[model samples]
Target: MKNIWKILMTITVVAGAALILSTAAFAASDSKTLTINATISARAELVLAPTTINFADNSPTTVSSVSADNPVAVTARVRTGKATAATLTVASANDLTSGSDTIPISAVSWTASGAPFIAGTLNKASAQSGATFGNGSGTYNGTYSFFLANNWTYNTGSYSATVTYTLTAP
Candidate 1:
């Protein structure tokens, strides 16, 4: 009977110690929860007004008269947003076509009032090497003058070319 009591007491003590250790290990840790967020902004944009330019016919009695008053003016309004720098470029080949016949782009030239460059000849290539309009923000109203000096005789018909103006924000 004495041996039985001693064995029971030892088993009870071991069980109690294991239970206490398990409870302490589980209670030592903690947990929490949170949230995250994000957003997107607007990009750079440009707008041009008076997209059309029309030059009236000038009757030249002499080559001097044609050369004297060959220049015509056109105004353009540029409105831009969210930009660092912008450039005004034109097509290199400013050609006027009728059926199978055509006139060369170099016959006409252009000059801008507030442009940061000297007057440049129009062409039919690409629109990269034109002129620097300016930098920063807001709207800019600029006038561009086109001139065609009558050094040679052109076939008598309608002579016109569509000029494309591109405002690139870089």
Candidate 2:
């Protein structure tokens, strides 16, 4: 009986040692590396409220400048480099015309209410900068109150002109 007990104890110790060693061997681990990539491109967006603006007739003597009924609300969004600049420009297709009469587009101008926005006259020959933004991605909001220089020399007939606003992000 003593010899049997000794053999059992020895077998148990050897089995325990074998189990611990097997567990350590199985503990070895390996990991696979994964790479991730994303792409972001430059983008620009612009919004103008009340696309059509009306300037009511007024006596040139009473009002030197005729203001539009409502100021235009503007919103500009841009995604650009940290060092790049964004710009908003306005250009007229042609002078205001009514039959054989005409009024120079430059007679129209605007005043802005927002940072970086500037007051400027409408130009038919070239684009005029309405706003200039410093580096980065952001959304800008502002208002443009337009006016037409009232002059007695202007034609008596109604005159109209088309103008375009452009936003650029680089």
Candidate 3:
């Protein structure tokens, strides 16, 4: 009887220890809850206006019979967005077209850029403002003017020529 009593006590002690260890285990309830996330951002794009060629402004400008500074200022604009720089090329070969008139302009060759430099402007007869840009809006502008020592030379009856303008990533 005494020996049986000792065996039962030993068994009781061992069982109690095992119960305590199991209770102290790591489990889903005791584990921490974690989280993660992701995000994206973007900006608007830049563009050009007059989006094409324009002749000298007919305002306060005079294509005098023999004046050098004939009011022949062509204008353009750069509607900005996410781009930093751009170049304007005459759209002759593989390019977009704009403008229609008998002012010796054509889908033939591009002359120059005007403003805001979405590309820049080039001059035909050197009028006034060659090329310029708007700072805040990322715009381009230009004017050109050269002297006509003899005006009688360009007085042709009617002419139609094409000028192409291209914009490059500058």
Candidate 4:
């Protein structure tokens, strides 16, 4: 009877220890979700019309007035992103030269229209210059007219000069 009671007490103590140890260990769980984002930007593009300008019916005769026979028209097409204004600049390759004599670019007068160049008045420049041709810019088009004066004294032999137009956005 004594042995049985001792063994029974041992088994009950072991079972109680196992129950305590099982309660000591625990399980926990949590869950969450994640999201990601990205973006792309738009690019600006500028295009010009009539890549070349040609003047015709130039007079070589002696004259006292600026003959306006040859007038060439130019236009621009632009596309911009989040820009409010743009500029167009005109440049001459070099002065019209013959031997040692030179004719400055001032001889060519320019006129602009569509909010900057005024519709009817003409603008003249002595060298390379720029003007605002667009406003509130998304995509816009503008026009310009150029005329070469016919009154200048020089040795004549097919005088020529190159002109360039550039556009900028900001």
Candidate 5:
């Protein structure tokens, strides 16, 4: 009887210890919170196909205006506020020049084929708007056909000029 009682007591103690350990193991828990953040800012991109354009000589009487690389493909991408406006502009470095002879930059004008794009003449003193967008975060595609007014007064020589295109998202 004493031996049996000892064994039972030992088993009860072991089982109680195991039950307490298992309960502690099951009840133990730890956790930490995590925070995430994301940010988007204003951005702009402009692309032009055939960065260089050439004008072929023609009779001033027969042709009132000369075409130079018609239908220049243009792409604009922008990211801005929903109510903010995105703008694209072009500025001429200088008038078409061959030595001392020159043609006014204003003589060069373009016709646009796209919404929000407007027809405008090249300007050396000021930037000309190529396109304007009321909505934000979009890709706009368009074409610009350039024309130079042909005049008998122009000095005949290879003439060239540089123009810059700017896209702004604000």
Candidate 6:
């Protein structure tokens, strides 16, 4: 009888504790999330070293401009993304020809040395008194700008001078 009473008391206490806990309510909440992504791009442009140039006395005048040889303006430019240095060279190609009424080319010669007169000193850009360009990539890829000597000997006809350029990588 004593043991039966103790078991009954324990069961009654546990039931009372469970009933009190169930009576108490808990708060409820909800949440949401949002996400986004990004994109990007880089770019560059060609940089002309000698953007523009002018020859001191390139205009060919029969009598007045004879004494002095016409100076050629060389334009060197490049496009780059990284730091670099490059060199460009100009050489003359002897493809000179004359019209039917052609005067022998041997008789006439330009004051400037066999093409690529290179002004006073050549084979060096350090002597460039004119505009010089570099993109840091050390590579120059673009059209070369220069003035042809105005002094010429002919019977009145169109003439041409061929020039070749070699670009070097840094």
TM-score for candidate 6? 0.30
Q: Give per-residue CA lDDT, model 4, range 1-170, as digits (tens).
A: 99999999999999999898887765355578888887634334545555555544445574433433333344444444454566666666676666666666566665655545333322234234445545545545456665666654655655567666666655
* lDDT, residue 159, candidate 1: 64
What lDDT score belongs to each candidate, Candidate 1 first?
0.57, 0.91, 0.37, 0.56, 0.90, 0.40
RMSD of 4: 9.4
lDDT of 6: 0.40
lDDT per residue (tens digit) for residues 15-129 in model 1: 9999999899888769888777765332334343445554445655454223313333333334344455556677655577665556676767666565453467777775544
The residue pairs that clash in candidate 6, if any, are 49-133, 83-136, 84-136, 84-138, 85-138
Clashes of each: 6, 0, 49, 0, 0, 5
- lDDT at position 68, candidate 1: 16
lDDT of 5 by residue, 61-131 (tens): 99999998657899888999988889888989799999999999899999998877778999999999998
Candidate 5 residues lying further than 4 Å off, grouped into runs, are 1-36
**Candidate 1 clash pair list:** 92-123, 92-124, 93-123, 93-124, 93-125, 94-123
C-alpha RMSD of each candidate structure in angstroms: 9.6, 4.3, 10.2, 9.4, 5.2, 12.0
| Candidate 6 per-residue C-alpha lDDT over 1-170 given as tens digits, one digit per residue, 9 for 90 to 100 | 99999999999999999887876644365578888876532223334444333324333564422221233333334434455544444444333344555433222222232222233212222222121334454322333334333455444555443334444444
> Can you tell me which runs of candidate 2 are displaced by over 4 Å?
1-23, 26-34
| Model 2, span 10-97: residue lDDT tens | 9999999999999988967878999999977889999999899988999999999999999999999999988898988998979999
Better of 1 and 4 by lDDT: 1
Candidate 3 residues lying further than 4 Å off, grouped into runs, are 1-85, 90-150
Model number with the top TM-score: 2
**Candidate 1 — worst ten consecutive residues by lDDT sum?**
64-73
Clashing pairs in 4: none
Model 4 spans with C-alpha error above 4 angstroms = 1-44, 56-84, 98-101, 116-130, 133-135
Model 5, residue 3: C-alpha shift (Å): 36
Candidate 1 wrongly placed segments (more than 4 Å)? 1-50, 56-84, 92-94, 115-118, 128-130
- The TM-score that candidate 2 achieves is 0.82
Residue 58 of model 6, lDDT score:
34
